[model samples]
Every structure is written in C-alpha cells, then in structure tokens.
Target: MINEIQHTAETKMQKSLDVLRDNLAKVRTGRAHTGLLDQVEVEYYGSMVSVSQVASITLLDARTIGVKPFESKMAAVIEKAIRNSNLGLNPAAMGDLIRVPMPMLTEERRKDLIKVVRGEVEDGRVVVRNVRRDANNDLKRLLKDKEISEDEARRGEEGIQKLTDKYIAEIDKMLATKEADLMAI
Candidate 1:
C-alpha cells in the first residue's frame, strides 16, 4: 500500500512536469519553429483538423516557415488558418506552399510574451503543489485506515515533498531559460 501511494504520487508529479514542458514549447522566442503552429486547426472539408495533419511544416530559413499542403486546394485554407492564429504570422501563398515569415518582436511584445510565460510557470508550480497536497492527504488517509503506520505516512509525505521541490525547481529553470530566449535578439 505504501509503495502504491508513493508510485502514484511520483506519476502525478511527473505529469505536471510534462505539462510544463508542453506549455514551454508553445511559447515563441522570435525564431521560426513549426511547433508554434502545432496547435492551429484548419478547416478541412466540413471538419476542423490540425494544420499539421493536412500539411507538412518545415523551416525554410531562420525567419521563415514553409507549409506545404498535401492537397493543393487546401492552400488557401491553411494560409487563412495561420493568419488567424494568435502567433501573428502572415502567410503568403506561393503555389502549393504557404511561406510564413517570422517577424521581429518589438520590445513591448517581448515583455508581454515573458509575462505570459511567467504566468504559465506559476500555473505549473501550482499543479505540482496541488499534487503534493493530494499525495499528503492520501498518506494521512492511509494512516487513519490502519493501512500505514504514522512513521510510514510521514516518510511518504516527505518523499512527496521532495518530488514537489524537484519539479518546481525544474519549472523555475525552464522559465529562466525561456525568458532569456524571448529576450535575445
């Protein structure tokens, strides 16, 4: 029972870290990244689909992304989807491919992106702490139910705290690195 609780807690904490990593990937750093459009959905026929599902996205240059639609007819739809995305990229339709040029970030825009990243980091920290709280509660419940002794529950709680600390530290490091990336010219 004790081992089960520890394993569950570790799993939850690891998931929180994964969430942080995914969030960080979505944040742009003034570079051309196909991942930036990973969340964009384009209207395909009568259904909405991920842009990547219908098109191949590639980095044509340091500041340009080339999106080639599998179906030539979907070129306009893909361009519109990228234009409408919050990424602020303008797509130019060039035959079967749409070229998206990444714009230079203004000082104000860079600061705004940093603020957004900071907010995401705080949310990730909260998720880690919430996992710790849940695991601690579960440990206490186990002790009360006579499944685990007080000493075992205490040790489990300590282990969960350590996991929480490690994940939170990882988030902090990611935030710092992202901030630097965003601020760089």
Candidate 2:
C-alpha cells in the first residue's frame, strides 16, 4: 500500500513537469519555431481545426515559417487564421503556401514575455506542491487506518517531500534558461 501511494504521487509529479515543458514550448524566444503555431486553430469548412492538421508547417529561416495546406482552397483560410491570431504575424500568400515572418522582439516586448514565462513556472510549482500535499494527506490517512506503521508513514512523507523539492528545482532551472534565451540579443 505504501509503495502504491508513492508510485502514484511520483507519476502525478512527472505529469506536472510535462505540463510545464509543453507550456514553455509555446512561448516564443528570439528565433522562429514551428511549435509556436502548433496550437493555432484555423476555420476549415465551417469548423475550426488545428493548423497542423490542415497544413504542413516548416521553418524556412530564422525569422520565417512556411505553411502549405494540403488542399489549395484552404490557403485563404489559413492566412486569415494567422492574421487573427494573437501571435501578431502576417501571412503572405504565395500560390498555395503562406509565409509568416517572425518580427524581432523589442526590449519592452521581451520583458513582457519574460514575465509571462515566469508566471507559467510559478503555476507549475503550485501544481507540484498541490500533489505533495495530497500525498501527505494520503500518508496520514494510511496511518490512521493502521494500514502502515508510524515509521513507514514518516519515511514515505520524507520521500514525497524530497521528490517535490527536486521537481521544483528542475522547474526553476528551466525557467532560468528560457529567461536567458529571451534576454539574449
């Protein structure tokens, strides 16, 4: 029973880390990346769909992304979707492909992005801490039910706390690296 609780808590903590990594990928740095637009949804045939589903996106250069829709008619719709996105990119239509050029970030804009990244890191830390709290509660319940001895429960609690510290430290390191990348000229 003690092992089961520890395994479940570890899995939950790993999931929290995965969420943080995904959120970081969507945040733009100083260069162009296709993953930045992976979440963009475009209107297709009266329905909204992810851009990746309708087109093949590629990074053409350090500041440009090329999107080619599988169907010719979806070109206009794809361009419209990018234009309306919060990314502030303008798509230039060429035949059946759309080219988006990433603009250089000004000092003020970079600072704003850094703030957003920091918020995401803090949210991740909260998730990990919540998981730790839940695990601690479960350990106490096990002790109350006499399912585990007092010594075992204490050791389990210590293990959970150590895991929480390790994951939180990992998040901090990732945030520092991303901040440096954003601040780099």
- Per-residue lDDT of 1-185 in model 2, one digit per residue for the tens? 87788789889999999999999989888788999888789887788899999999999998899999999988888898888888878889999879999888899999999999999999999999999999999999999999999999999999999999999999999999999989987
**For candidate 2, which ten residues in a row score worst on lDDT?**
36-45
Model 2 has an lDDT value of: 0.91
> Could you give me the TM-score of model 2 versus the true structure?
0.95
RMSD to true structure for each model, in Å: 1.3, 1.2
All candidates' lDDT scores?
0.89, 0.91
Residue-wise C-alpha lDDT for candidate 1, range 73-174, written one tens digit per residue: 999989988899988889999889899999999999999999999999999998888878888898888888898888998888888888888888889899
User: What TM-score would each prediction reach against the true structure?
Assistant: 0.94, 0.95
